[model samples]
Target: MSTPQEEQARRNAAVLQAIGAQQPAQPEWPAQPQPPQEGDLWVPPLGPAAIDPTATAEEGAGKLSLAFWVLPDAVFGMILALALQVIALFGFMAAQGLKTQEDIQSLQFDPTFTLIAAPTLGIGFATMAVMRIRLLRKLPWSWFGLHLRTIGPALGWGTVAGFAFLAINFASGLIFERLGSTPDQAEQIIGPFRSASSLQLGLLGLFIVVVGPFLEELFFRGYVLRAIRQRLGATWGIVLSGALFAAPHALSITTGFIGLLAPIFIGGLILGYVYQRTGNLWSCVLAHSINNLVGFLGLLAALSLP
Candidate 1:
């Protein structure tokens, strides 16, 4: 009884109803952007590709290429540190009226050289390291293992590990001394500690316990080691990092009685491992601070002894 047009309209409506019944319901809200899948390279807002959180083991090996890792963080860092140290050294010499090379050599044993020069070098190293990581890597400071959540645990473990290392070092030194294999490097290094004024001592302690550790751990473990680990895997990364850590202290090896290279190398390995395990910079820094603290206390105690 319906008109032809009405019949066609009804048929169309029925067809549409059947299609709607088969189709899935629309989401109430707009769909969120999907996260990058595993094996996907993450392009940072700036710079080249950044770290992939879910990268496969093989892909991760080349996540940080050698050119980027070594040039900015390692080589440039060393250059910056050296340049700053040279400036500091010259300034110190000028202030003290030291003209000859011999005069500078003598001043090396002075508190100003140890306290001021060493800290200046550390400042330069740390500043350059931070700049490189932030600018070149296009990453935040937090990427360098600066998370607040891991601080307490990192510090606690670091303290324990540091004291243990000190004990081992002490025992090794005693054994070497008994065997007449050790030299008289302690006097050369610690002599300044004995003669320094209370103010100087305090400054030196501050550098050793806080500034030095923070800077060193931030660079060596946070940046260099992390990069190497990402590329070369843990074993090579830890070893190479420790070697680099020890390399700077090479001069001390010639002067110290027991030679600091082995202990420092071992310490570097331990610190690198701790950082790798915890992914926390504070842990290594605290550990380094504790190690320095023990040495500081020992120097104080020795001075106090009659």
Candidate 2:
């Protein structure tokens, strides 16, 4: 006859064994007991049950989707921009008979600039337009990361990135001069801003340095890069995005093919990486705008010096 304490110990051991809380070889064994079949029966263990449908659906939908935002805008803008590039390239071929840098520079028309700026603006607007109707009214502006939240970091990164690019271009020019080769043509690209009237310089600077960066970042980093990352995966996406970025700079014959392509490629990679790390367009825009402003200011200062 077991004492009351011994019986209580036996019951506790049985529950522990049923729940797999005791080692199989341990001597604290109790017979496996079935529930008295009066109402609900104890179910033996099986592996974990499948997750609920609602939980599975929520998990699937939780991630940030770049594909949903970037593809259509890029495809539309690319088609339009490519056509303009072809026309611009043809004009360059036709104008090749012109002599000296000044004559070559004179052929650049406002329409070409219009053609270039229009498609980028169109795509950016299109993306924002879609997002506004569908998801959130503030989606486009939010995509640009226009919060008072990150303004400090954005400005700091922008200044650093701008200085870095200026240094690279300066170093490249020195290297070329050392090799007795023509320095990069981007050195001359912003020369117009140096001689323009103050008002003209302000307008041009506003358009080129500020507006241009906003539009390009909105399209390239916010739209094109995101789209490519979705369709092609990150590595190829980065390469293609950078190449596409380089293509527009081909409009300037001064940089020629190689010189123009190099910086644009580097810029694209940097901007893309910035977007990847920050998950926002503000940093890229800051980096790009700062680079442009530095280039503009450097050229102006050079022109002013005796």
Candidate 3:
């Protein structure tokens, strides 16, 4: 008789065979590999899984490059500015029956069109820039330095900074005037607004105190400055971005009054520094708005004087 161990082994083999008979037969072709399930450690094929050295750094880092940020900003900004100017021109023509180039030129100073056009341009450009940043970079709005937590402090600081900047500007202007230079072209540009109807003046005031500052801060301090800071170091970034911010306004600088560039550049630096420190776009916006408000109030006071 077989030993107990031998019998047990035979019985186990038979039982396994019986169970195997109940199962389906194996396929002729090599069995297809099973898909990896949870808890599986899958190793991709060596060649196919290799990382590409040529892949874009920005894509790898999941952020836009400086070029991507600036190009769309400039192109869309110019387009929007041009489009708004054209629309304003058409609106002015419809209202005033303007036909000749001279008529349009003369009416360019109309407060209603000027006030409406300026804010519309700024808002449109800012909206485009924000949208580009969102869609292309897939970034959150807060990436543009918009935050509510610091808004109150930002506004308070902004107010103080605005007043200080105004004081400096005033002192500089007085010194320049004493040096036998004529008034800045900005004065000429603003002179007509002083004579605008109360309604136009009110609209202009709203634009200056609210829309203008918000849009400018969003574009300059929020978008441009942030992109620059990401690429260059903070110091050069702030300086370059501030210089860019001052460029367009430089066009308004009078021939003999190049000193005006200093104030605009200085203002840009202050706004940029505030944005950099607080990481709050609204802080800069509020500061700029307060500055504009002060100027607006001063204009009104001057106009009211006999």
Candidate 4:
């Protein structure tokens, strides 16, 4: 009769085989038949962690410990992106005239800013993100929660989520106004688009709805959120990533800076949660684009009135 130790060895050997790993043809087994007690598991020490849904916290923690380089990769890539953006912004300001305080204030209102913002930042971020994945992640698109197989549902559900979040975002803006934020704030965003020619509007739409969302989602949810999630558990990963998503605007130490931060932070949390649940970056990107589109349209409409 086969001893319990030998039987356990054979079972572990079978599992290793199923996962494309090799084991000794006849693995050495303990002489004594130390049969496991009831409710005990026969874990394989030589293999990677099992994918059991009921895995212990220790196993889960070990799994989360992987991808330690993810956040560092994100930070490095973001620095490169910011540097490129700053250089481009300086060039644009020089070309379009930037001599006074008023000129700097009016930069965001410039149509040229809208045109160039996406391409420069998008290219820088995308290039770094891909390179980091190739050199460090050594994983497929699925690791970033972005795979072609999930494209259809990702886009569809993402678009729907976008509209829903847009409504909530608009409501939040109204609450801000009630708390003394002026509706006049809309002009800063709408100024460039209000008088845009048809071609300019089209290009703006193409960038905002497509390029901007795709790149941001890929960087934020795919790269940043994934890295954090691998380091922390799901909830902290989502929350911290969402906070990081809004960290740029919140750098200013003014109350109004908070006003800018709040809405984006809320949106980021929801998007991060969605990415966690769905494991598809496309959905988050589509939803973000929808939010941007509706917000822009509403601002432009407000401009048309009165």
Candidate 1 lDDT, 1-306, residue by residue in tens: 999999998888789898875445676998776787898755544322233242132222234464255435565666777787788788888888999989988876788787766765566557766776676556667777898876777777777778767876777677766766664445555766667889988887888778888988887887777766656567777888888777766544355534466677888888888887777788888888888888877777777766
**In candidate 3, how many Å is residue 236 off?**
1.8
lDDT, residue 120, candidate 4: 60
Cα lDDT, model 2, residue 92: 59
How many clashes (backbone atoms < 3 Å, residues ≥3 apart in a chain or on different chains) does model 4 have? 0
Model 2, 84-129: lDDT tens per residue? 6566555654656555667645644333333343344334444553
lDDT of 1: 0.71
Which regions of candidate 2 fall more than 4 Å away from where they truly are?
Answer: 1-140, 144-151, 176-195
Those runs of model 3 whose alpha carbons end farther than 4 Å from true positions after fitting are 1-64, 180-186, 253-257
- Candidate 3 clashing pairs? none
Off by over 4 Å in 4: 1-75, 89-109, 150-153, 182-185, 250-255, 303-306
Compared with the true structure, all predictions reach lDDT values of 0.71, 0.58, 0.70, 0.69
Looking at candidate 1, what is the lDDT of residue 33? 60
Return the TM-score for each candidate structure. Answer: 0.72, 0.57, 0.72, 0.67
Model 1 stretches with alpha carbons more than 4 Å out: 1-68, 71-75, 100-105, 178-185, 256-258
lDDT of 4 by residue, 1-306 (tens): 999999998999889889999655787788875676898775443323232122232222223443465566556766776787788788887897788888877776677675776466556556666666645446566666778766787777787778777876777778886887533445554677666777877787778678878887787787777656654667777888788777753432345555567777888888987887677887898799888787667655775776
Q: Which is the winner by lDDT between candidate 3 and candidate 4?
A: 3
Residue pairs clashing in model 4 are: none
